[model samples]
Target: MTCQELYIPKSLANLKYLVELNLSYNELEGEIPADGVFSNITIQYLVGNKELCGARSLALICTCLCIIIFIYWRCTKPTSLIPGTPSMKEYCAISYYELVRATQNFSESNLLGTGGFSSVFKGELSNGTFVAVKVLNLNSEEALKTFDSECMVLGMMWHRNLVKVISACSNLDFKAIVLQFMPNGNLERWIHSSTTPYLNLVQRLKVVLDVVLGLEYLHHHHHQVVLHCDIKPSNVLLDEEMNAHLSDLGII
Candidate 1:
């Protein structure tokens, strides 16, 4: 057993950044605390340790997920599912566990940036695909409303220039939206970072064009007549080819 079965306090349940439980070869036994600390440290690595025998945690989780999925599947009349095809729905409703894993327990080192509503962090999934997670700690009713409003608006736009929303997770009062990673980071940094070359007028003009084109599409082709309510240099992102994208479209 290579993990620590510490007395995971229930008070720490809201903290999403705690990772790594090296309980290794401990003589601790008898029904591990199932919530808070114990719940997160579910992976008990047992080698030649006999004191590790206990009720299986994986079974409980599987059962819970199955139940939840069943209920959600039943209640939510999925307006998705194309005719005569697989139901591998796009824009999956990301789970808390997935979000945690992606953000490396939401570590600050993985943090890509921050803004008025939340902070953005760079993360990679089990599949190695990099993603950026925007986490907003809604401390008040007003913040929650704003979060909901932004989420609702961003959830609809799928334009090339507009920022893309991969998925979202709301768990334990923590709200987060996962987006595809912009390898070059924000356009503001790319154009201004001392480590990078400064953008000439031509490059800047191209970026503006891309940003406006995205907004135009949102205004016209998008499902909703969306507005790029918040537009600034900091909100633009550049791709590998220097193709500009308008990022972070929150609500008014």
Candidate 2:
């Protein structure tokens, strides 16, 4: 049996007297838990999981940031969920395992869209909060750059006309940015899909105005003049109220 993306859960380390664990020839990601049976497992047992690492000599040395993020998740479990909350760093520090579970292991049914280097999936958190998880393909350097840029920029800015980034998740095999899911979808669908009476002139103007306002904030109100290299119908999302909000700032 081959698993595309396997996360060695923390609970597996609890197994006692389970010797001779052989996990070779399987695709695995994230840190190898350095407790319980895993501590004694040899490199031969974990071969081919290039993304797996920890205190084990066979694995790569985990960065301080990754370790810190893991520790935070291990210690803290939020009791409630609220919109516009200020737990940016904490909320963003999520595990690939959590995202997989949230999105039903990235089932095709939850897939929203796919770009040049990533696929967006609809996810629901344990607290019933919805999010759009943009999972990037790490094999592409451009995708990595986009992920980094989006995270840095989104962390620093906020505007009603602009899409909101709620949190982020990163691991050896998985990297994603969690965003506020737009219920109405993007402007492209309304414009191209065979929907009822096309957007009236007033609605069209409102969408244009929303895009202009979002761009204005990024270019003028922000500390720096941010440029969105790509602005198209698909990138302009609409909320439940049909209010347009500019999204996909990865290339900005």
Candidate 3:
């Protein structure tokens, strides 16, 4: 086949005593069979098929297979062996693979927002619990510190006006904090979105009051005084009932 568009039949490898196969100048785009007739063919017989690859293609396939296996192993492996702190004991431990599955491997569509040191994604756990996963950028030393700060602060505190911590996944390579998922999203969206219904004066007042309560608990009610260095409309999230809850205490 000269200048024709076709794939070399893999069955050709099964032919006994078959030799001198010439598949030059054809649109053969895939791994060449490494058996039988193919094993005997030289570069001359398969010349001009730029898309055709041999050992390189096999190596690529092998690499892809390895990646798939690695992903599968991560997903199936249990996180029970990982040690947890006293605060972590209060909630169920989550594995890195579960977070991967929950967020569809951190697909762009599942992303809720991006910040300086991390990105937030909406996900659902295997137990059907909806959660917001704040994955920290491991590359940044500040992000690592943020992860530690949030874990230390959120794990010990609980207030209705504050977003609750579900669990956390921390490893040398990856760190993520799981928090209660707010369906209504942040206060910034409500204030900025032209498509959605605008908040009335009463609703606005209630939202402000909710934020004040959350801040009050953090500043005074807790056993230790915690300062929320960053407080903005975007940092305030709303639950299903439109009740506001302050979040993102990474800099606490």
TM-score of every candidate:
0.60, 0.63, 0.64
lDDT score, candidate 2, position 29: 76
- What is the model-wide C-alpha lDDT for candidate 1? 0.66
lDDT by residue (tens digit), candidate 2, 170-191: 7777789899999999999999
By TM-score, the better pick of 2 and 3 is 3
Candidate 3 Cα misplacement greater than 4 A, ranges: 1-86
lDDT of 1 by residue, 147-204 (tens): 7666667766655676667777776678888887888878778756799887764466
**Order the candidates by lDDT, highest first — what do you get?**
3, 2, 1
lDDT tens digits by residue: candidate 3, 41-138: 65556767778777735554565576568556643443212233236568889999999999999999999999988899999889898899999898
Q: How far is candidate 3 from the true structure (C-alpha RMSD, Å)?
A: 22.5
Q: On a 0 to 100 scale, what is the lDDT of residue 155 in model 3? A: 84
Which pairs clash in the backbone of model 1?
Answer: 1-25, 2-24, 3-22, 3-23, 3-24, 4-22, 4-23
Index of the highest-TM-score prediction: 3
